[model samples]
Target: MEQDTNQNKVSKADSIRVKLYWRMAVMLLVIIVGILAMLAVIVTQGWSVYKRQSAWALASQKQAVWGLVNDARFKLEEVSNMQTELQVNLDPVFGSYIGAGSDFDQLKDRFGKNKGQFNASLKEIETQIKALRGTNGDFAKLGAAVRRDFNQYDRDTNKLLNAGDSGEDAVPYEQIEQDMVRTKKSLSALKARLDQERKAMGEVKALTIEDMARTLSILVGVIVVVIAALILISMFMIQNFTANMIKPLHESVRHARALAAGDLTRKLNFQPNRIITENSEIGSLCLSLQSMSEHLNAMLRQVDGSTQRVNLTSKEIRTSSR
Candidate 1:
């Protein structure tokens, strides 16, 4: 019986330990899950920020390219206007060079200098357009077309300048105008494509940032729920452990105190058979107290019997002496 009681006690202790271990494991799992969720959220948010920054940078590049395109377009328009002015005045200048013969060389030199500057400007514009071409395939194609048109325009401008330098009457006004129109349209197309890309990039950035915020919010909510659950479960376990272990030990202490005061009449009433047989040290202690009380009761009964016999014997002797 004692061995069985010991085993039962061991079992109850093991049961409590198991409960504690399981609860601790559950809390650990919750903590780990919360940490992993937070890490995932951080990584996701970081990636979103990176993507947004990249998109913004690309949009800025596109805007800059658009400005360069406009600049090129204006340069082309200026070249076209200069060609028209030259065409209108070149014939009269050539006639005056032949008739007046004075200051003719100076006039030719000034016109040559102006033509050189215009050609240099056209070359610079071409270089900038080529630089923008590799940024987008469609832009490249449009830029190539623009380059072809501008090349033709440059050729016409050269032809007009050459005719004036040689005192010739022929000019390419019609061809120059056609080339200018095509160049303008191509520049417009390039700008339109850049604008479209920039707008799309902006939209993508907005959507990515919004999604990151939403996901972070949800993770935060999950963390809050996990923390709350951990707190609640901890409180419940504490209450249960205190009630089952501490309360029983306290009850055993009270019973032992009663036995210590020589109150053998007072029962060690650990109600509910399960509480007494719970394989706990407190239960065993309560049982020992009960056994002690039973032994004390038997001893008291024997002492009372002895006292009664002594009193009856003394009464008989007194009567016999009388």
Candidate 2:
């Protein structure tokens, strides 16, 4: 019966622990989930910020390439106009000079200005191509083609300017015209290539950013699951400690109080499944209380029997004296 009572107390404590710990678990789970959620937000925001910064750098590089392409296109137009102007002046009707010296001098001045501008523009394009070397080899190839054609055009222009002193009619207009045509075609192709490359790069960057976000999302999801598992395990540990350790201590205190109130009929019931072992201090204390109760009850029974015998002896003395 005592063992059964102890088992019942332990069972009741476990039931209460289950109820109380559920409430505690809810509160703790909320706090843990909130913290994990905050961490996920911070990580996501930080990664997004980094992704934006990286994308911005790539965009700036593409913008630089765009600006260089525009500058090259403008320079190419200028060179084509200069070549046409030179061809018009080379005509015997338009360029009938006061002297051969003035004709050579004017041609030299015009060719020098055009050559300097074209060289500067070509150099800038080459530099941009070098910067985009590993990024896009096709761009560099297109840029090289443009440069080659422009160089050929420069040579033809210089030949015409040098040959001008011979006679206006002797200028190689046919060769200059062919070189101009080729240079213009190459420049147009280069512009088209630049536009296509910009669009492709934008698409690639967008896809890369999307992949990174997806990866981060997977990682955060795993972290959240692990954190939730840890929270549940911690809550179980707390419940176990409350049920096994605290409940046993409370039972010991209650038993001690009952003994103090002179309830010797009741025993300090110890169940086999209890956390407090018979070798423990609480176990010894319970043993002492049980021993004290038994000793007090035995002494009370002896005192009552002695009082009954004394009353019987007094009754006999009273009858003899009467």
Candidate 3:
């Protein structure tokens, strides 16, 4: 019987006591948990953004290099086209030198004008290629090669034009043209290389964009998960606290009210087999209310009995006198 009694006894807990310690501790724990969680999120997101921004800066640099390469290619095309016009004017200049086709001064002036324009384009290529090399170490070797090729081409073409200026007799046209043929070959190679680099940069830019998009999606998902977890945890904890403390206190108030209204017969705990255990402040209050009700009921019963006896005594005296 003793073992059964012990087994059936309600458990004791000191949580939700009159002291403020337990509630304060819960509040502090919640605050610390929230702050720590937010800090972790901020650190993680900040690092990711920093890395992505670095990549974007690198891409912008690549774009600058690409633009330079492309501009060099355009200038090369212009120089090549102008060379054809120089070729067309070559015959008239030679005829003028022989005293036959056109005025010598007019022919020379036209050829010189075209040559000046061609040289302008060559200078632009030189500047743009140098810019490409200076922009980044990766482009340095290619830029040097293009510059070397263009220098050789420029020298050879100038030699040919100077030979023409000397006279038809001094011009070794075929030999100079042969040497000049290889002049443009270097530029063609550079153009091909620029094409390849442009394609590669495009691919890298696309990949970077995709990576940033993926990281953004992951961050959003992590934030949503953290928020949802916090909300659910808070709800569960609040419900437990209400049940253990708030509900019990509310029940104690109702019991006290009934006693004050002379309803001493009403039970503190109306459950058939359950009793409010005196394990915390709320339970202690219910116990005190029960005690108060019992004493008041006893006093009221004594007063009622006395009143009935006095009335019976008065009626007996009246009957005897009659």
Instruction: Give the number of the best model, judged by TM-score.
Output: 1
Candidate 1, which ten residues in sequence have the lowest lDDT sum? Answer: 91-100
- lDDT (Cα, 0-100) at 278 in candidate 2: 45
Winner on TM-score (1 vs 3): 1
Q: How accurate is candidate 3 locally (lDDT)?
A: 0.58
Clashes of 1: 1
Q: Which candidate tops lDDT?
A: 2
- Provide the clashing-pair count of each candidate structure: 1, 0, 0
TM-score of each: 0.63, 0.62, 0.57
What's the ranking of the predictions by TM-score, best on top? 1, 2, 3
Q: Give candidate 2's TM-score.
A: 0.62
RMSD of each: 6.4, 8.0, 8.6
Every candidate's lDDT: 0.63, 0.66, 0.58
Candidate 2: tens digits of C-alpha lDDT, residues 29-96: 86777678767866776677577656656655766777777886777677677666665555444443
Of 2 and 3, which scores higher on TM-score?
2
